[model samples]
Target: MLYFKHYAGALLLLVMVTGLISCRQEEPPLQKVLEVRNLSDLATTEYHITKIVKASDDKTWYKLGDRKILMSVEAVLKAGIDLSKLQPEDVIIDGKNITLNLPAPKLISLNLPPSGIKVEYQEIGALRDPFDNAARDALLAQAEKQIRRDIAATGIFTETENNTRTLITGFLQHAGYNNITIRFSPQTPLP
Candidate 1:
């Protein structure tokens, strides 16, 4: 009788422990979604592009003669998704499978360092004065604008979106998710 009582107590204790463990609350999937949203900007692709800055004073009547300047400038373009746009509805969890709907990637930054600009060629007619600092600054500004306008044609946005998916997929897999599906919200118009 003593042996049976001891075994019964052990069995009861084991059952209680198992029940507590099974009943323990698992973190809701929405919590994980918020965690991802906190990641903010996720820059996935960068492009080092060189642009030509050319200007001529021949068109201006105030100029005595033709004055031209040509310059080369390198720009850094970065594109990525802004995770802060993620909503709870964007994340769908089914058992081990998870589907994350993310906003489409956009231009994160465009850097045109002064050090990246170089004078390639200059021509000042004998009757014309050399290009001033203001002229050079204006030329650089025009070049920057052109680069921004041409970004969409370079296909960087598409590449950025692909890289973002690959990155988030690996991250979710590491978080113990088995089947992962990453979908992007409709892309916003490009600048």
Candidate 2:
């Protein structure tokens, strides 16, 4: 009986040691390399239009060719994951003729500010019907008020001038604004 007990213990120890040794974790596989011959050749590749803002209208009130044309536009483009397979430095543009070159692309991702404030602006452009300086100021004030109210409704951030600016700056940064400076006073009184 004593000899059998000692052998059983030895066998259990041997099995555990062998099991641990054989159960090594495997390493992850490396990413595959993409083969891109010509970026222009891939002009037909679909691109996602993230945002578009128009700021222009036809202006022809005076004589022939005397009228002016205003233009305001902002657009964001994403090539999608298929383009990710290509080299990051490569550039692709489509028009009458496809243009391809190496251009550094700017990538930006923005998070909503903790304050729950939302802000947006239209692209600049000359307009026939323009707002007066005072009207523009009033518009800005209204916008600020709306932002404060929206944020307050969410109850996410304390109402303070510094916090508002911080939240706005953070949101802009997340939205891919490389150089962003938000300037505004707090609309809501601090709790």
Candidate 3:
């Protein structure tokens, strides 16, 4: 009777272990949410700026000498949306139609290469100062500002926005989406 009791206990334990092992089955892989964004710069503007500076102070008691400097500059400006600024709610998809809210176009960069800058003419009086490196750098900075203004006046943002919409719409269409709506955030100015 003692042998039978031990044998029965061992058999029960083995059967329970086998049952637990068979009950464990492989599960399907976990699904992750899809995130979409736009970070491509599609439009750019090249600007040529010319400025004449008379480096003279009017408040001087005596009629001081004048130094005239003429500068010509070529710069490039880029505008685009920053995808990192996107939020999950910015994208909406329903069946084959999709809507995306994009950020406003911003000045991505201002490139004024030294080779593109030229001093057209310079005239300095004997008693007046000459155009030094610091003065030239300041002039270049002013040229950059002028280029920005010119780009704005030309409606570069409008062009960029249109290009972005077209590009994104095409991309979505290729990805199996039929209807696409694109809108920009009004809070971000085109400056």
Candidate closer to the true structure by lDDT (higher is better), 1 or 2: 1
Best by TM-score: 1
TM-score of each: 0.84, 0.18, 0.69
- The true-versus-predicted C-alpha distance at residue 63 of model 1, in Å, is 2.8
C-alpha lDDT of candidate 2 relative to the true structure: 0.34
Q: lDDT by residue for model 3 over 1-191, one digit each (tens)?
A: 99999999999999999998889873321111123343344343333444343343434567467677877776766677665566667777777777788878777777887787788888777787788999988888877766666666767678778877887787778777888899998735335
Q: Per-residue CA lDDT of candidate 1, range 1-191, in tens?
A: 99999999999999999999889987886686569778899999999999998887788887678888899999999999999999888888998999999998889999998889999999899898898998888888898899988888888988998999999999888888999999887766665
Model 3 lowest lDDT segment of ten: 26-35
| RMSD values, in order shown | 4.0, 20.0, 10.9
In order, the Cα lDDT scores of the candidates are: 0.89, 0.34, 0.68
Worst 10 residues of 2 by lDDT: 72-81
Off by over 4 Å in 3: 1-64, 149-151
Each candidate structure's count of clashing pairs: 0, 4, 0
